[model samples]
Target chain A: MSATFSAQDPRALAEAPPMLSLRGVTKSFGAVEVLRDVDLDVRYGRVTALVGDNGAGKSTVIKAIAGIYTFDGGDYRFEGEPVNVTNPKQANAMGIEVVYQDLALCDNLDIVDNLFLGREITSNGLLDDETMEKRARETLASLSVRTVSSVRQKVASLSGGQRQTVAIARSVLWNSKLVILDEPTAALGVAQTEQVLKLVRQLADNGLAVILISHNMNDVLAVADDIAVLYLGRLATQIDAKSVSHAEIVQLITSGRLDVDSARATTTISTGERSGSESTDQGAI
Target chain B: MSTVTGRDLPGLADAPDKRATTALSDYLAKVRGGDVGALPAVLGLIVLALVFTGLRSDTFPTTFNFANLINQGAGVIVIAMGLVFVLLLGEIDLSAGFTAGTAGAVLGVAVTNHGMPWWIGVIVCLASGALIGLVIGLLVARLGIPSFVVTLALFLALQGVLLQIIGEGGQISISNPTLLAVMNSNLALWQGWVLYVLVVVGFGAVSYRRMAKRRAKGLHAERFSVWGFKFCTLVVLLGIVTFLLSRERSVNVEATSIMGVPMVVPVLILLLVGLTILLNRTAFGRHVYAVGGNAEAARRAGINVANIRLICFIICSTMAAVAGILIGSRDNGVTPNTGGNQTLLYAVGAAVIGGTSLFGGKGRPVDAIVGGLVVAIIANGMALLNQPAGVVYVVTGLVLLVAASVDALSRRRAAATGRF
Candidate 1:
């Protein structure tokens, strides 16, 4: 695939405000390039949907952002300042939390424990159970997640949806300003998908920037504020959710090339005006 | 794996505003959570006692026999207490036997040879054990060697050292008056019984108060009936033990005031209690579980996994050393072969039988005590029956098998139930 990016125009886009941004991100596994010149942005209170075909670098982008992997040629910026995230702990320290697909929960531990995990609050050299359980319950309640009866219930006893909620809640619980979710609704039933989508939207509405990596187009459409489509190793386009339709995004996902003629034809500039537009577009065609 | 039933966690979320509970309530919550695993063991003890009583009739119920049982069981119980922590992390400490032997030899050198104060020698013994633990921890964590290998090496090396220390002699007899006094002398029978009662009651009371605090703070309690039942059972058991030890000297026996029970019993009990609290209540304890449960996960969570493992090995080795010293003190001497043969086997067996999973992350110091008692009882009972040492070994092996098999089966069932 050709590098369709206009190099000069990227400087202007680079100046745009970003809550979290990756510039010139490049990743390679041996000789295969997974992510090449990938530039992405997430704005505060906005859900940026990262959609791509399998192996289209969605995971690479998310992992780099979450500090699961270090990209070779990228400047990662949080709040428009450059930062190097060497590990997940570093990412967490910088207010970046990643909720992976498996959720990484201890089945034997209760909701409060899973939420706190490694960051348990203790006093007098002992686990402060009361304070932890209290904070856990309050956090869940604040998130409006009422499906579960209590925070002390073990995560193993929860349904898939409730587990997802716990996972997401845990990532966003402690001073998090950015949350990255990978395949949040991949295995969920209809009701569960609805619950998780609501949570994603809720997270963004709560003033946190959310980077949602999903393969489900419909789910993305339901929760995303701005949809960024990645084709091959490069980001093809990012369109306002209000301006794009599911079918148009799907075309961008499958073919990488936009059907400009069809998009223009549907906009109703008139048949005679369309003919006039084709005359100007003839040189490029 | 038992499936996690929602019913198992009843009222976890229903408790409204538990954080507002008093300090007493908070303490209660912790005690309640810690004691959840002890009920089954307690029940097993009662049933076993009743069954043995029924089967042996005259022999099992004899007062002399009961005292003998406590005396013989005390040493093993101490060893098991230390082994429990090692097992809790799903690790084993094979060196405990040799570690104990080494400590015993050191005590011999300190008291008999150097004429050090018994107290100073005791301190040195414990310090030596802690140092062994530290070495084992470093080997396992920093050197990236497995604990089994590290401990096994220590076990062999320590055994050799103990033999050399004994200098071809089979035993190092203790002649220190103070040391002998501790091992052989006892308070008035009634006084000893009273002291035991007070200690047991004190702990039970602390446990009760802690549980009550947790309940007040809106944390889950192990059913109100369960806590009451546990408390009542403990009281009854303590009463029986104290009563048994308080029995009058045999009618024909000369000293009507058969001095108080051996000091080993209380020391063993205290060690078990202290270790249990340390394993379950402290941040270090939690880190141990985290590392055992999943080292990678623990590391990702910002825990220093290597450091936790290192510390655990150190603790385990140190405990082993303490156990050795206790054994030597109880016997009033140290021997070249004191900790060889079945010592490691029994330590591991006691730990396994006590219900600490070989898989780690789910066990307690109490389990080790129970398991050690079980082993000691078997040994004492066999000796009473005039069974040979070989027979005792076979029986112990079978008992260990049974314990391990039962644990495996129960865990498998728990997993199936999704209660993991």
Candidate 2:
């Protein structure tokens, strides 16, 4: 659907344009405010894990980023440029995709069909099955997906892990620059979780900005390069995942503060400066 | 025609097509995998056929009865074909029977009362059917009303529309010669054979072209042997049907010699092929399945699911109109009872019996044709044996129940195997 399988160099990503930066993003439903003054920064070649407690506005932030909800007030920037995305289609058109936790996949359709669901390739008004099949195979192969035997196997016949992989792969299929995943591992087994988390890291490693929302701090700490925590409808801090500990993330999630009134306390966004634990998490991913 | 019959040998390694033995085993494995596409319908047809062949019907064994079976089943088959669209969307059109009746009444009124040409009447009838479908579709897709409830309301309302069209004449006897011929006439014996040849050759040409195209792309195509066997089997089927239909079906050879395939056969075939292509080959068809399987997913994929649902309803009511006209032409009149659940239930039964999943996203138009045959045979055989209408209804109902059971149980089996 895009130009070919071109991945930007991870090393060059530091100098690359910023993928998505939200400044003072606010959302409300009638009288109740869900999110207020939320500042989030997602960069290329990095997984920004957006972890929060239940109803801590993590979903609201994701929906807002995916253009499922309109921000009551905010500046939504894409690739260092300002743009208003009022719908999911606009987000998709801007190379932004949100893979919801429910995994919005048609079980009756095969991998190829599912991948090209609304955007089927047509020649002479008929589905160009061969071309689509070839591209699906190429994409899956590039992702090193081996669990699936055939591209024609229906989504229903796939394991939870494979389905998750297909869902993730679909976002990249369209040359997406920023992907927001919501609770991807909540229903998956441990092995599938590992597989998904790896796929998530690979997305970032391939120079795409990835936003992951999960309740599990372990998953967030293991693969994320920048972990953004939200608590009580506000972003507490966006810290370098490498610099932060699992307890720090948990503390932020619970209390909406990284540290007690000392250094690196709150509302500070950190960069990917590696640490002792960060290298191990990188290897695990 | 079956989408379930394929191997998934991972990446670029194109799995070679299996031989006949492997193909057979593969089919068995597919059945075990809860993808029993049309097996039940085929087996049901055979069982019903063998039982009726030696039963009390003097005409059931005749070539005339064989031809009669086609005519008797054509209307239901067409309706069922249309129903496949709605069913594929996991939606129901309960008013389809009456929609057909209302549309047929429009034709009858246009031609018989207003002295319009048959073609104009046909257009008017079809448009009316489209309008009816549009209304039902709007209610379901736009208003977010359940299709079952919306159609049920139309089912009652359309009956009144038909009654209003009949205008206390009690019935409208079709006077147009062309309209009458749709159900009463037949193709010449030579024409039937020529059509058969053309169909076979066309199928071979289309299939081989597709295979060659895939091969050109360095992609796996169905094996020549596998496709050859399928072609041969289809040819044999058409050959038998043409040969059987070409025989002298009239009691007296001179008066009304019905010795060719009925015109309805071609009509049925045209609908079958067109709808099949629409479903299996087109983007619209693919989107329909997507919407049915998971609408939220389809919406995220930027598919206009509501539009798809609306179109499917339109197709259903329009096909139902065609069926109504066919039945009206066959009966030579549009009576008050011209459209009823007797037909809708049979068409639904035919669809389900042929393995078109009521749950949607797992059906083909061919399923309707096969299932229609099973329903027709049951009805025809029961009629020939001097069985009352009650028996026919009961038997048909039981058959549908069994088919639905198979569907539900297989769905469960599929879920157990993670095909859910």
Candidate 3:
């Protein structure tokens, strides 16, 4: 998995510019500052994994990027130009789409309807069902998604993985430049998870900047080109996935920072004893 | 890494191979899985007809009785149709009855007292209804007030307004022959036949065009046999109704031909068709279902959830106004008691009985028609048996309970089976 990351160091690739970059982004609700001085960069044609423990403000960062919440203070640069996105509509207009964790799909509606919902294609004052269905099929086909039996099948009838794929496909359907997927595989089975991870890789390969928010270390390690770790409302570090080991990432997540040599020394000592107590101590911040 | 297969790739060619269940079996499975759409209502209608036929064979199946039954059902049907929209959002409008009365009162005051043209009065009534709905919608959607509470307040307030408008006499005779003809008149036999033919042909053409479009797009379309069966059933049903309505029944041995379909039936059908199109084939309709299904999801999708809720409420109240006009026409005037009593209850009952869910997002416009007919049949059958009003009320209550239970049970089944 690390070999895949080494084959493509996303930051070193100068062909695609950074699609979105945030510097000194701060957000607070009342007196509680959820995110403070968070800096992040999402480059086009690259998969950037944002991973953190609970209450680490990973969601706050993604929400800020998706424009679900306004940043109290920040410089938001989109493709080398500074921009302010006050709402989801403005973000959408700027070609930034968020595939939320909940999937945001109507269970009663069919795939065709769900895919073209809110922006239905109408010809001569009536819904052009045929055209919409055809477009939905074409979009799914482009993604190589073929598990769905029919476009007319309702979302409720779909499996967790298929629903995730449909949601992801919907975001990209509107000519999205940056797709932020929040825990795309959190509720999926193993096979479904594999399919979603593949689709995520395909999105980045298709030259769309992808920001994946996930808790699964394996998923992040397997697909991410650059892994950005958040710890306690602050960005601990952003590092290339190939250069880091599992214990190093864990140490960074739990303690907000990692002394690489000390972490290696601790790992070596723990391996000899194979004691759980020492491992826990090593994880402590 | 595992190789991709049809199970993992939904758009693959082999995906269809896994769906080996034939269309007929699939449909049967859906029915068995408790997706019996309007079957319960249709079955109830048939059973009611049989029971009435067994009890009062002489009068129950007569042309005049059936016509009168439809005429009486028309107002409730219209109201129920409006209620379906509200119910689809898992919301209730307790004020529909009084809203109807308010519109009727407005119509009466404008046309009779103020000497406005009947059409102008109708416009005022409809506009007033929309305004009332807008207010309730704003209170419910914007202020976050519960619809039950808001509509309940409107129910009381509107009833008082109706009473004030009618005054001590408790009635305002319309005196407009044109308005009275809306519910009291019938289409000629030829006209009724022509209307039925036009409807049948229109439906057939639409079905064919849809199938052709699907086929052309290489999508899964309904089979020819399925379409034919549906078309034939509709034709046969219309034929039987036309035949029954065309029969002339003698009044007091005077051989007075009170024949042909009631004028309101065709009007109701037109409204039903129009609403069905709006609900099924429009972007606004899609947003409505989306909001009803999951408001949070709809909001995230950039749909204005509050706006959708407001529009649905407006549709409900506007429909109530239309029903109000029908009620006034049927009674030949507006009375203080016009939309009081069990009218709102009956409308809610009809929508639920026809399979609209109380938990929002799982019903169709046609449910109103099916449920409305069921309520009407019960009332008509009871009246034919010379049953007291108390008995009618009890029976209606019991049926509503049964319908609601069926809805709850079916929802549980759908959830258990993982069917939407």
Candidate 2 lDDT over B166-285, as tens digits, reads: 987799989788999999999998999999998999999999999888877666667788889899999999999899999987898777778898999889889988998999899999
Task: Give candidate 1's total backbone clashes.
Answer: 31
Q: Per-residue lDDT of A1-285 in model 1, one digit per residue for the tens?
A: 001111224333234477787777889989999887777778767789999788778998888887888888877888878988777778888888888887677665677777877788888877787777766766666566768886766666688999999999888778788889999998899999999999888777666778999989899899997787777877666656666777777876776545776564452222242222222222122
lDDT order of candidates, top first:
2, 3, 1
Per-residue lDDT, model 1, residue B1, is 7
Give the Å error, residue A84, model 3: 2.4
Which of the predicted structures, 1 or 3, would earn the higher lDDT when compared with the native? 3
Best by lDDT: 2
Off by over 4 Å in 3: A1-15, A27-37, A72-74, A262-285, B1-21, B253-255
C-alpha lDDT score of every prediction, in listed order = 0.72, 0.84, 0.84
> Candidate 3's residue-wise lDDT over B1-420, tens digit each?
112222243444422222324667978888777677888998998998899999999989887788888888888889999988888888999998889999999999999999999999999999988998999999999999999999999999998999998999879988798899889878898999998899999999999889878776666677777778889999999989988888785475474557787889888988999989988888888888888888888887778999999999999999999999999998989898888999999999999999998889978878988899899999999998999999999999999999999898888887767566
Angstrom error of the Cα, residue A186, model 1: value is 3.9
Candidate 2 docking classification? acceptable
Clashing pairs in 3: A145-B11, A146-B9, A146-B10, A146-B11, A146-B12, A147-B9, A147-B10, A147-B11, A148-B10
Model 2 per-residue lDDT at B160? 92
Ranking by DockQ: 2, 3, 1
**Chain B TM-score for each model?**
0.86, 0.95, 0.95
Q: Which stretches in model 2 have alpha-carbon errors above 4 Å?
A: A1-17, A28-33, A258-285, B1-20
Number of clashing pairs, model 3? Answer: 9
